[model samples]
Target: MGSVNAISKPTPVNPRLSSLPGESFPVCIIGLGLIGGSLMRDLAAAGWPVFGWNRSAHTVKVANRSGFDVSGDLDATLRRAEAEKALVVLGVPMPALPRMLEAIAQHAPSVGFTDVTSVKAEVHELVEQHGLTDRFVGGHPMAGTANSGWDATMSGLFDGAVWVITYDNAKNRGQRGARLWLDTWRRTVQMAEAVGAAVVPTVARRHDSAVARISHLPHVLAEALAVTGDMGGPLSLTLAATSFRDGTRVAGTEPELVRAMCENNREALVKALDEALALLQKAREDIASPGQDLHRLATEGHAARMRFEARAGRKVKDAPRRPIIRVQPGAPGWTDQLSSAESMGAQIGIF
Candidate 1:
């Protein structure tokens, strides 16, 4: 990565390239799994001529059979994207990101890029190594079901969802922070917001660290709890109801995905796990006491959950809160001359 001495409009360094708007530039989705298929569906429905490619011939056949424009040839897909000045969104699993990056680097080195992959830091690093950050912005739509593949995909899945964008806003950084100066990056943000997703910006490492604690850790804990409860006997499964089912439902998600997430985010997840164990230990100690301590913990947890729900709604107070003052009849500032109700009302033009 190189830095510019001064701020400048981004150039392709290859003069023929234009910074086209996302709508004018076609979108070539390199994978048609859950997130990719949903993106393809929504964009095509919105009137953008979308193109798709996939690793599986069966998946390609399924998409083409369903009346989508697609091709299995990686080279052809890259050529069309280059001709159209398209943005390519990689929607494969975390494990597949590297191979796709390698292919894209070889075939379409100049095309703009983003991904719907959950992990960020590693992908950002890979993009830098390929020198593709000039045309790449790392993105993760913080939306999904615990489901996988094309059949599980649906439109409007990103509505009202927070789309985490990993890019530095700072200057002085070149390839790694090209997102700051690139017209293509702005268009990508617009494209994401156009899909009814709110874009939240942060650096790649920060995105990964936050996701590990919030997203990956929960999946880990859910699977752990499900297994722990079942250790008692087969009867435990029969006894499981709403609470048990809802709490551990993610435990049934594709094991390969869970394993990949855990492995990729091990460091931050381990830290989150340590914090969770400390809290669990505190809960255990409080449960032994069973009256004040446990009650207080539960009360605090309930309050936090309520606060979370409240904050998730629209119209949260984004500005700093201010203090309010009330003046009464007997207060120090009160003067009998103006304190008369009629006199004050007349002065203030109020009744």
Candidate 2:
């Protein structure tokens, strides 16, 4: 996504929103690991009613002791979500998604659905298989430390992060049905913004592809970098400094979590890995040749890094103001219109 060129006036909310749940609806988070636990803390601190569920009894106990509304009983937790008309966020890892979706289907069948999973396409598929797509909006927050579990969770983890929201599985649900999805979307955008995260609307497939290059591929590279560093033996370990440490930072993440994140987006990650390997192979060939140098790789890499910095260094307040693009849910091609605007870097205004 790039900067939007068109700036317009604020669009009015869809009239249908008046018939749906109010803004004060609670949040029910499933899986109290880092992402979910942090969400529970932040939402509660911001004064939204929030509760959560974790499979581990010890984690639930720890969270409860820390004054969070988390429990070990899945059924009881989902029952409360239904009673409270909450927006449900699944924060389980990719390997655990199917089982979690099954529980959601059997327990709280119709609540607003979303997830904090690293991958989106698979989640979109599973949500449809479980008959939850009508209310589903997939999400991934571009934030996390090389940490996991309740003990590793902390507040402000999502602050200033780009929270990608996907609508790839959505359909033309007519006017009344549109209201349901729209309400769910609004609530999600509200929650993300409340936590100081920018909501970046996109389709699931694109989100997965983009993250594979910028996120999953980095994890793979980091793992390889860390292994390479170790192969240099004791002298390299003692002499390692900022560059080596920074490059391999994510390699320090829990191995299973790293596997789930990278493997879940296997197709995209493999393509990204192939591209990266090509570059490394070229560099190796250059090293073998007598007069050749890393001129091409270094120049290209430097330009790419500069582009990223130019885009990242621009603060939201520093950018030219642009109107939030509005979409009439369930209208003909409404989702398409939203997707197009998102490609132009426009934020989908909450209805």
Candidate 3:
């Protein structure tokens, strides 16, 4: 639970790493659950060898049985990655990141590393503390369902997803290494494209805040809805429909992870909740008044939801095609222009 110096934007991939041959590298994924197992399937299908390990022997056996190269020994897993010059992806929960990074630093110092933790600030700090900044990148793929475990994983999970990458661009020591990292990202992006996800850029703080509004807050609200709707009445429970179930679906997530993420990002989440509460209070007041613009809130919410659904549908249909507008150098006020363009559905290249 340490602090990481916040990075403002996505760093450009190191030219050096990009210059390497288009050869595949072995990848070691720890924790053969949803994220890890999905990664293993995609990478293996892409012609890259994948090794995996999990705390549960049954999970490891399942991965192996499913034709993945898996082992139960942590050191053995690291050794395999070291022998193959591969990146070890830590796909476990946030609480396990520090210990996993420590283990990697001590046992497999030379291997490149990354992770799939939703919250990155703490994990980034842990990697820095281990002096492995040059060899690691913090990653979070913005895709998942209310599911867990190796059995639940699929190859198409990350298709067209925004995979956030956070790193120390200020320090130029890993420029060449960063390129390789991006090459790996290109593969991930391709997978996302294949699966109907749109690649987007976001820093750790921005990601946390945005997710708090759309993802985290929904979970909290859903749980609240479920609790308020049913007070031990079978009739109330039986009356639930698709809309009600969909609205409260995320409430089914592991409570411990929900608690951890909420506690870690409490500040941003609190602000989001407060804003939502204010809007709700205003709506209630307006509804009770003689001449209040209650319809304005309804209109805004309807418009927003429509826009979101439209964008989601477009992203799914356009997954196979590369972004149309690549951000180029020498454009006047290119940064602002590109941002504006992207907001309007133009796909700008990631620099």
- TM-score per candidate: 0.76, 0.84, 0.77
Stronger candidate by lDDT (1 vs 3): 1
Kindly report which residue pairs in candidate 2 clash with one another. none
Tens-digit per-residue lDDT, 1-351, candidate 2: 122321132111222222232345689999988899888887776656899899999998888888888888988888889888899999988778888888877888767878998888988998878877878899998888776888888888876567888876566555655677777877787788667566678999888888999988999999999999999999999999999999999898889878888878999999899999999999999999989999999999999999777657332333424335666555677778778867876655454
Model 1: CA > 4 A from native: 1-24, 173-181, 234-239, 289-292, 313-351
Clashing pairs in 1: none
Residue 38, model 2: lDDT of 88
Which candidate ranks first by lDDT, i.e. highest?
2
Task: Write the residue-wise lDDT of candidate 1 on 92-167 in tens digits.
Answer: 7777777888888888767778888887888887777876666677888878887878888788776656666654
Ten-residue region with minimum lDDT total, candidate 2: 5-14
Ranking by TM-score: 2, 3, 1
Candidate 3: minimum summed lDDT over ten consecutive residues — where? Answer: 10-19
C-alpha RMSD for every candidate: 15.5, 7.2, 9.2
Over 206-275, each residue of candidate 3 has an lDDT whose tens digit, in order, gives: 6677778877788788888778777757887899889878877777788876787677778778989999
C-alpha lDDT of all candidate models, in order: 0.67, 0.78, 0.66
RMSD of 3: 9.2
